[model samples]
Target: MKHLRFYFDVISPFAWLAFAKLPKVIEGHSVTVDYQPVLFAGLLSHWGQKGPAEIEPKRAWTFRHVYWQAHRDGVPLQTPAQHPFNPLALLRLAMACAPEGMTPGRHACEKIFRHVWEGGGDANDPARLQALTQALAPGRDPNSDAVKQALKASTDQAIARGVFGVPTVELDGRLFWGVDALDMVSASLRGDPWFDGPDWSRAAVAPPGVVRPPKGNP
Candidate 1:
């Protein structure tokens, strides 16, 4: 059996999009998707990651690329608010639902992702997160005792792992960042050529300090 560690910030639209498709993509593998909820900005600061919107050329191309991908996948692609609040509460609720195991974890994460991106609901809004929580677990509000306790546990685990970002997949002692890396994660699971070392992994390599090629220069 193989383990796939997934660290993601729920507020990321790209993460939401990736999460939506991941289940199907990994259906054939004997893998466990471990969800690690973390702070996106913190992770970015640590790894020096910048959102496409932060760079003009990157932002323009990314908009078209994301929309086209979403369209191809038949998923809605919305321009989420700049710095769409942190996903802390959202992570807490997901943790609450998964106290025992991932059966509930996947379900919980799915609901949260849908509410935030698909439904365009405000996850940072206490009322909204609570309402959605109630919808999933009868009479259990996000602010309730049960939810709060579970959230604490999840947060503790995150701190232990030194996690602070979304769509961060940890495997083989390596951390793969971003939703776009899912393919590589999947390929690694299947012992694909790239994971074996040439095709997939090296294709994404950039010269040191290349900075994503300043967008259009690629």
Candidate 2:
């Protein structure tokens, strides 16, 4: 059986869409998926980059594109009451649901994703979060030091794996990013020779024609 690690942050609608479609994408294959919840903000900070929501025009385009993609893909998605809200609570809650030294399972991940994307509600509302906490019945305290540390470790691990974004799938040490890469993932899972071709290696080693200067220097 193949093991696939899905790294995500609920702050991203693309992650929600990818999570919803993943089961169908690997239906016939014997694949074990590990749902990993990491902080999107942490990733952005580590990479010295801003999220789509942080850029005004890209933020609008991102929402519009995701909604259209979700509709086309038959995945249910609703924008939360706010964009780019703090996801620390949800991330910690997910980690708290896992057993010691393990990641959260699909049930916990689905519940959290649904809570944010299925209803047009405030994901961070105090009452709603309390209700969600009760519903999850986490084995550990979400706010506990251990849970927070675990979440940080998970994000650090992701960064070490060269993950700079959400909704990434790691299979056999190959990283596939974006919801649109589902087909590529499926192909790889089926042992497609395209992955074995020279193009894959060549693309990675391709030289950049121009270099952008540092912010202050430019």
> Which candidate has the top score in TM-score?
2
Model 1, residue pairs in steric clash: 7-167, 7-168, 8-166, 8-167, 9-166
The clash count for each model shown is 5, 0
Please list the Cα RMSD from the true structure of every candidate, rounded to 1 decimal place.
6.0, 0.9
For each candidate in the order shown, give its overall lDDT on alpha carbons: 0.67, 0.94
Q: Write the per-residue lDDT of candidate 2 for residues 1-218, one digit (tens) a residue.
A: 99999999988999999999999989999999999999989889999998998899999999999999999999999999998799999999999999979999999999999989988999999999999999999999999999999999999999999999989999988999999999999999899998888877888987889988988995
Q: On a 0 to 1 TM-score scale, where does candidate 2 land against the true structure?
A: 0.98
Question: lDDT at 87 for candidate 2?
Answer: 92
lDDT per residue (tens digit) for residues 19-74 in model 1: 87788767888888777666565556655678555788887886688678889898
| Candidate 2: C-alpha lDDT | 0.94
In angstroms, give how far residue 27 of model 1 lies from its true place. Answer: 1.8
